[model samples]
Target: MKDTGSAQDAEHEVTMLKVISDLDADLNNVVKFHERVDMSLYDLLEQREWEHHPLHEIRPVAKQGLGVLHTDIKPDNIMFVNMKDQPLRVKLIDFGLAKMASQVELGMEIQPCGYRAPEICLGLPFSKAVDVWGVGCVLAFLYLAQNLFSFKCEYQMVFII
Candidate 1:
C-alpha cells in the first residue's frame, strides 16, 4: 500500500511537470506577443475599455494577454516537481480566487491573508500586481520551506472580510 501511494505521488508529480512546462511555454508566447506589439502595461490600463468591469470582464484579456497571473498563488496552491535538484519546475493550481485585471482600482475586493498585498489589505482595488505579490509570497515559502504568514486565529475571517 505504501508503494502504491508512492507510485501515485510520482505520477502526480509527472503530470504537474507537464502542466508547468505548458504554462511556461504559454508565458513565453505571451512575452513574445508583448514584445512584438510593444504594448505596455500602462497602455493596457489606460485603454478605458474595462472600467467598472466585473472580475469576469477581464478573463478574455487574461486569456489573450501577457501572462497567467495566478492571483491566489501560494505554497499549497503550487506543486514543485523534482525539488531535490536544481531548476525545479512549479505548477500553479486553484483559480478559485483569481481575478484578471489590467489596472489598479480602488475599493476592489480581492486577496487572501498573508498572500494579500497591502493595497488589497487596505481594501483597495487591485491589478495584476496582486498576483505578483502572491508569487512573491510563494517564492518565500519555497525558499524557507515554511508559510510566509502565520496566523493563529481569525484566518478565515481575513479571507471572508
Candidate 2:
C-alpha cells in the first residue's frame, strides 16, 4: 500500500529553483541601485518605469524568459520534509503568487507582509532577484529566529520612504 498524501505532496511541493545557473545583470547602464531607491520607493513598481533597464534597443518586457518568480515567499511556504529511508530535504511550497518573470504587469498584488522585496514594495519591475531577496529574508529569519523588518502591514514596510 502507498500513502496518497505523500505522493500528492511530493508532486505539489514547489522546488526552490527548478534550475540554477550563473547569471549577470547589465551594468553598463544599470538602473543604479541608488536610482531605484531614489525614485518613489513607496510606489508600486508597475506605477513607474519599472522596466527601465540599460538596454536602449530592448524594452523591459521584450525578451520573455522561462523563469518563474515566486513573489510570495514567506516562511510558511518553506519547510523541511523527511521521507521514509530518505534524507530530509527542504522544499518551497505554494505557488499562489507565482508569475512569469517576464510578465509586464500583474493584476494581483505581489508578495505578502514582511517578506516583500524592495522592488515589489516600491512597485518596481522585478526579476528573479525578488525570489532571491525573499529567500534571503527567510535565511535571516532561520539564522536569527526573528523577522528582520517586522511590519504590521505591507504599507508599513517603508523603511526608505
Candidate 3:
C-alpha cells in the first residue's frame, strides 16, 4: 500500500491495536503489570478455532442497524469493575461512535485521535476489525506504559509503528 499522507482517519489504528492485544493475551496468556496493578488481558478469542457450527455466532448485521462495537475504545473506557466473589472485571463502555456493521458505510472514519489505522487513513472499507485494533492498542498501552501508535501532529506515528 502507498503511503497515505496526513491524518485523515486519525483514530483508525487505535482499534486495530486493541485487537492485536486481545489476540496476544488470549494466545499467550502473558500478563503484564502496569503501575503495580495487574492489568488482565481481554478474554475475547475462543480457545478453539472457529469452525462452521450448526448455529454460527457471527451473523450479518440486521437491517435495523445494531451491530457490535465499543467504538471509542481508549484506556479511559476500559474501566475496572468489582463483582461479587469474583476478581476484578474489565468493562468496556462508551459506544459514542458505535454503529451497526450494516449501517457502517465505507469511508466513514472512526476511533479516537492517535489510534487511527492505515486502512481508515486510506479510506478503505472497515468492519469489526476496528474493534480488534482498539483492543490491540489497549494491550500495547498496558505493555508500553505510553501510547504506542499515537500521532501527535504529523503522521510520524505511522512510520514509527
| Highest-scoring model, TM-score | 3
Candidate 2: minimum summed lDDT over ten consecutive residues — where?
Answer: 28-37
Misplaced by over 4 Å in model 2 are 1-66, 83-88, 104-108
Mark the regions of model 1 whose C-alpha exceeds 4 Å error after superposition. 1-69, 81-87, 102-105, 152-161
Per-residue CA lDDT of model 2 for 40-141, tens digit only, reads: 111212233343323331222122222567676765654333333322233344554566565548344677767778777777766777676776665555
Please list all clashing residue pairs in model 2, or write none if there are none. 43-122, 44-123, 45-123, 45-124
Model 2 steric clash total:
4
What tens digits encode model 3's per-residue C-alpha lDDT throughout 63-151? 01113554666656554333333233444444445555666777876777556666666679777777677666665655454577855
lDDT of each: 0.46, 0.47, 0.48
Q: Rate residue 138 of model 1 by lDDT.
A: 51
lDDT of 1 by residue, 1-161 (tens): 36887676566555434444445534432221112232322222234342332444223223222243445555455433333451223334444443335433577655556677767666765667777676666555444444457433235435543
What TM-score would every model get versus the actual structure?
0.46, 0.52, 0.54
Query: What order do you get sorting by lDDT, best first?
Result: 3, 2, 1
Worst 10 residues of 1 by lDDT: 29-38
